[model samples]
Target chain A: MTNDHHIRTRLRDKIVGIAGCGGLGSNCAVALARVGVGRLVIADFDKVEVSNLNRQYFFADQVGMPKVTALRTNIHRIDKDIMVDSHELILNPDNIPEVFNDCDVIVEAFDSAEMKLMIVETVTEKMPGKPLVCGVGLAGWGENNDIGMKVFDNVYICGDHLREVSPDFPPIAPRVGIVANMEANQVLEILLGKMNDGNNTQ
Target chain B: MEITLNNRKETIPDGDITVADLIRFKNFTFRLLVTKVNGRLVKKEARDQVYIREGDDVTVLHLISGG
Candidate 1:
């Protein structure tokens, strides 16, 4: 079989899942939408608040709306043909598999440390073969270019993997957007078979 | 005991060390770490209960979530 090289049609059948709808999740979805990912399964149990506007892909009008729904609407604005399956509920180990089972890749964009750990651990354990692009240690502004990416077998982590968010260093826009798009880029690489497989990887 | 820690060879004086014990022994004070022993994920609650044997492959990733 021959490979499809056309940029627009290559991702026509790909399905990507986003596990959070906050800063990283929203921004990542937008980036993926722009790139024409076929389907996105997004889940979140929160609403878009006014404070989230500083770094999230939500507007003031969408403050009271559920993030998954709002993000879906926004993604449609970019490409109405792109299918978005939005789930508005708290995700746990039990429901995670059912929610994102068919997704080719999953993005972990949770804010709280517990949720981040839960999603990463769950996906890694249950979905052994699928790729999980995650964000960690992305805090503060562009004082330094410490944001980096870590590659494991099935897990790809983006960030410095150290700095924690605090009063002195809050999660800002540019750096967060960078990590979010990095995650989107990772998904593109995985789907396009650009990632280095375990072949001869000793 | 010798084991592969993050792809690097390391020696642990204790032959049998629990995941929690290893974390403490190594001073892994990071609140968020996704640990795996032999490609199997070990959650936070199970760290103390799970033991790392000789020649085990272990990975402990540091992470922070604000977005």
Candidate 2:
């Protein structure tokens, strides 16, 4: 195999923190680990449930396990050398900074609207200038083409930019994976200093 | 009378209009929405208090849960 020094040396040195180890967090963590991100800080207060198997990376056997711990095990299965910092604690505005202090880029992967807003607000307030990759509007089986990226200062929002979850429209695996992978790609792009202004890869 | 809504020039009533009013006027029914005026985030509670003037850029983003 040809050696890619840049990806092995530079990319592996970066640290990424993922908030909320649900579908987005779990999938994104695996993507990053496959690409060889040096360290990962994953925080989540919840445990794995059967419903999460639809999109989340955890398996059926992993149910009832704490999400952070389960995620760490999954990521290590991909890259045992990758450093994993798993925190099984709820992240609020008051403690976000402390939990994600060592991370270079923080990924907002919460499922609730209020929690998403709180993470964005708290991160922007306390960690000014830190890059944050966030996911929004990845509901339903809408056209995958609608999935896009939007950049605001240091915050990168990835999703279809429409279609909230409803009785008629639910969060399926295809759309969720598209958004999750977009978020993971953004983290890698930001780490490699390759991200530019405007939308990327609709 | 006119302001840029999501980068498209639109006309609103010739008077003060808050972000909440704009959201209603545009018929954005999404429960989870994020609004920013001129690149600054406007909290949900403050959307009613924050007014939009002419020539300002307004972006409204909808938040959803799948991943």
Candidate 3:
């Protein structure tokens, strides 16, 4: 096969599942779609609010729309032919496996620490050997270079690894985008079987 | 006793130190954190009971959010 065909074939056979359709999930979906991922399974029960416009991938007009549907619409806008399995429901440990069973990689993009930990723990436990990409400590307007990636067993975590959210430090677009892109890149790396080259951990 | 904390070698008084005790010893005040010992997760409720031994790899990650 030609090099171009080989690249297309690889992207066309992989599926990614995102746990939240907020900033990280929505942006990651767009990146994956642009790269021609075969399918995406996205879940989010919350609706867009005016506050999410700062970092999330939703326009003001999309406020009040369920995040999953809004994200689906947005992803289609990027690549109309990309297949998306959108779920508009609150995800719990009991149902996560069912929703994302076929995914080769799962991205944990929840906003709360509790939810992030829950998804990471549940998915790792329920689906041993499946790789999970998660983000943490990307808050504030600190130096974007602080964001980095680390690999622990089957889990890949991306972010600054410091600077928790506070009244003074808030989640903004630039830093969040950096971490989200890192997560997306990690997914691509895992799918392409390049995870063992020794440069991914940061 | 000596243990590897986040990959750095550190020495503490020889005895059994629960995950909580180690956190206290390290002065980790961050509220949003996840602890793993030897590659297994130590949930919040189990921190006080989970013990760390010599040569055990412990990772304490703080989970905050921007996205």
Candidate 4:
């Protein structure tokens, strides 16, 4: 039962912000907390519902709870010491800056295409050099090989650029989980890699 | 002029086309676009002002989806 004492200590001071508490954000938050990220700023305007259970992290009992609050409670179950600051409201271009300005890296886990575009545009424009791990398209199934990443300076986009979820192509658990965890992995790589080799000006 | 776009070689019919024109000509309507010219980030506002040159390495990626 040995823990990653050294890795944990290194990550204990870092903060990660998640822009949505849906399939991508909730799971990424859990993964980051497990790896010892010290603080989290989670924002979501919606409440947990039965429909989201297929991919999101909320328990059946937690339905009707605001996504941000529900995710914070679930994260605490993994590690109570982790600090969580949750905002339960819609995130437009205006409030995003005030809410996530201090996070070391921001996770864009929104469901709508408009919100996704807005987050990327706003974060890259306003935050300047902040690292953003964003999920693009993981709708339907069986294109595992196609699920790769693209880099645009500070933003890392994971998932196929095509395929938006619709009535015909809905998001499922496995694909969502894979991309969500990929975002988490990117967060750690950015954080720990920076720690290991200082900042490499890109 | 020919340019490397998203790793593929593409020929742009216009001689002096900006990033905004390329996006419109290519019909890439997705708003979640991130454009890079020779590794330098070109913000959304500057896309119309940034021009694409021959042999330039350009990347216009639809980094997210609306769904």
C-alpha positional error of residue B56 in candidate 2 after TM-score superposition, expressed in Å: 3.7
Q: How does model 1 fare in lDDT?
A: 0.87
Candidate 4 wrong stretches, greater than 4 Å: A1-3, A194-202, B1-14, B24-32, B36-50, B53-58, B63-67
Candidates in order, TM-scores: namely 0.91, 0.84, 0.88, 0.85
True interface contacts retained by model 1: 0.78
For model 2, what is the alpha-carbon lDDT of residue A72?
Answer: 93
Task: Pick the winner on TM-score between candidates 2 and 4.
Answer: 4
Model 1 chain A worst lDDT window (10 residues): A193-202
Candidate 1 ranges with C-alpha deviation above 4 Å: A1-5, A195-202
**Roughly what TM-score does model 3 have, to 2 decimal places?**
0.88
For residues A1-202, what per-residue lDDT tens digits would candidate 2 score against the true structure? 2334546576687899999999889999999999889999999999999989989999999999999989999998888999999989999988899889989999999988778878887876678778999998888785878878988767899987677667798777888888888999999888775635422222
Candidate 3 CAPRI level: medium
Model 3: residue A187 alpha-carbon error in angstroms: 1.1
* DockQ leader: 1
Q: What is the DockQ of candidate 1?
A: 0.76
Q: Give the TM-score of candidate 2.
A: 0.84
Summarize candidate 3's per-residue lDDT along A38-138 as a digit string, tens digits.
89999999999999999998989999999998999998888788899999998999999999999999999888888887887786578877899998877
Q: Global lDDT of each model? A: 0.87, 0.85, 0.85, 0.85
lDDT of 3 at B5: 71
* TM-score of predicted structure 4: 0.85
Give stretches of model 3 more than 4 Å off.
Answer: A1-5, A195-202, B1-4, B7-12
Clashes of each: 0, 1, 0, 4
